[model samples]
Target: MKNEPIYLDQEENELLNEIENGEWVSNPLSPQERQAYQNNAKYTKSLQEKRQTTIRFSVSDLAVIKAKSKEMGIGYQNLIQALVHNYAVGKIKLEA
Candidate 1:
């Protein structure tokens, strides 16, 4: 069969052959390096940061929201932001 380069180069091919023949290679990371990595990882919680958001809603509110959005014609979230900001800052009130 013709010599073919499927994935590995010469050094990688040698390493694969050594592994296939049951030879052992030294660990790339020492115990201290492994410990440092474990310490830096987020084990118990997800990462959190501020971000822009979008949401979908029901048809009636969506129609009103979309028509108002077209009149303004900027980012659709801007109207949502305005309404939420006004309500949150006590300019609007919830009926129920």
Candidate 2:
């Protein structure tokens, strides 16, 4: 994808502003520092551990989920995971 700037969310604009402000400037990382950064990044990501599972959904339902996720600026998988987690924690409820 082209790095051409596109108007997106607040975060994207904030990143651009940070770049313009030279907030992203940093001293070159030494080999050890680079290694440490990589290790820490891996560890941090591991804390967000994931499990693979499968579920069946109707085509129309899946489409709606995908569309809603896009509208919310998140991937469908993340949106579904958040929804399920919220429901499990009683943050969301079904009313009939």
Models 1 onward score TM values of 0.39, 0.48
1-96 per-residue lDDT for model 2 (tens digits)? 699866779988887888999897657999999999999999999978988999999999999999999999999999999999999889999999
Location of the lowest summed lDDT over 10 successive residues in candidate 1: 42-51
Question: Clashing pairs in model 1?
Answer: none
Tell me, by TM-score, which candidate is best.
2
Give the per-residue Cα lDDT of candidate 2 at 59.
99
The superposed Cα distance between candidate 2 and the true structure at residue 47, in angstroms, equals 10
The lDDT of each candidate is 0.79, 0.92
The local lDDT score (0 to 100) that residue 44 gets in candidate 2 is 100
Best by lDDT: 2
Model 1, 1-96: lDDT tens digits are: 478757888998899998999895877998999988877675423333336676778889988887889898866577887898799889999999
